[model samples]
Target: DPTQRGGVILLSVISPEKYYQTSPLTLEACRACLRGIAQLHAAAWENTDLLQKATQQLSKASFHLTVRNPKELATCVESWKGFLQAFEPHMKQAGLWDKPSIHAMGERIAKLAQYISDQMTPSLVEQNDTTTTPQFSPYATLIHGDFKAMNAFLPKKYESACSSSDDNQH
Candidate 1:
């Protein structure tokens, strides 16, 4: 069902080949994905206020979904650390990334998140006195917040057949 929040439920027919074997990924597919993501990010960058509103809604949803102590920021950080620790082993096994480099990048992200926590929030009493400059940039456009291999779909047989026909003339 399409919602007022702006999303649609899409349906597609999956081939049996897609179920039994991992499809060979091509460079062209990767490039197309990158292009799509770039376009998404560009759109988000253009709509900073809307993005911020969505972020706030997500943050509230997170609070309702978890039982972590709101007073202890380290608790939240530790949960994230645990997730990375668990995910890294499977990520390595899947040959998705180099283990040590993945660990290093995870650490870097944690450091940045810690820095944001340490600097951004202050006492509620002082909140009204505080003002923040919007952090949107022309570089920050619409981002596909959830991107994965499963989202990709190949063109139909007829489409590929036409492409091959054109290639024979070259």
Candidate 2:
């Protein structure tokens, strides 16, 4: 009865006081986050052999979600508002907000996001007939459904780099 089960030894839970120190999450740290998501999607897309699989769905969603221009979108408006609130002080401090380079970069990123959305359509078909199964193979991949701070463990490199304010380098 005292022997280990399945050759496994269970360890006692540690106290919360022994937890690691909390550090701030920054937008600069999210490049790898975005890349990881893209990699997962690419793997799934390749395995499923579906190209614009939900074309009808995307068309409908686009009808409601479409905007004449990227800057006029509600999300962009909210984003710009938050960006101004968050970075206006920093810009004023650095004297870089009024520069053309920053404005051009912002426009470029906005346009790129819009372009990607324009190219992507629905990848799944809604079922109308119970007798028929969708032709496409189901491709599923592991997803970190909740990738918030609680699920994250800092790597040594990230821990060291976090102290530096060179967000641009990330």
Candidate 3:
């Protein structure tokens, strides 16, 4: 329906070229899938239709368990120590693990926590340095926030179909 505001609808896949969740087990396949996702990001960046209709409710860039939430961030910080205690040996066996790397991971959690804290209450955050915050393109873009193996599907080849996925977010 052209009169409808939604852009996407349930797509019926054909017999020969059915959409499947090719869950990118190999490095090259993962790269290809990620490249496909990147294209979607670029295409949807600051699309006028999205901006006009859903800007107010959907301005937040990321929709995750921890993003923009102070308590979840703090919980992550506490969990980090326990995670290290449980998985340090396994991580060491995987190699490339070191004290500095461990510290850096903790530092990232702290920075994100501080960022959320500052955003929520700037008066108390004396070291409210915005530089450490993750940066994105100035233009706001809609993303496949739930892009994963279960949620994303691909045709036999990317050439035959669009590299888009339905997240059912809204």
* TM-score (C-alpha) between model 2 and the true structure: 0.38
lDDT ranking from best candidate downward = 3, 2, 1
TM-score of each: 0.38, 0.38, 0.45
Best by lDDT: 3
Superposed model 2: Cα runs more than 4 Å off: 1-31, 49-75, 89-96, 99-118, 125-156, 163-170
Residues 10-95 of candidate 2: C-alpha lDDT, one tens digit per residue? 35654444432134544444454566566756754534343433332122322222423334553664566567667776676678
* Model 2: per-residue Cα lDDT at residue 77: 44
Count residue pairs with overlapping backbones in model 1: 11
Instruction: Name model 1 segments beyond 4 Å from true.
Output: 1-24, 48-103, 113-142, 154-170
- Residue-level lDDT for 79 in candidate 2: 68
The lDDT of model 2 is 0.45
Candidate with maximal TM-score: 3
Each model's Cα RMSD: 10.4, 12.5, 11.3
lDDT, candidate 3, equals 0.50
lDDT scores of the candidates, listed in order: 0.44, 0.45, 0.50
lDDT of 3 by residue, 51-153 (tens): 4343344433243223445565657767777777777765676563676778467658767755443332212122356666333334545555458765666
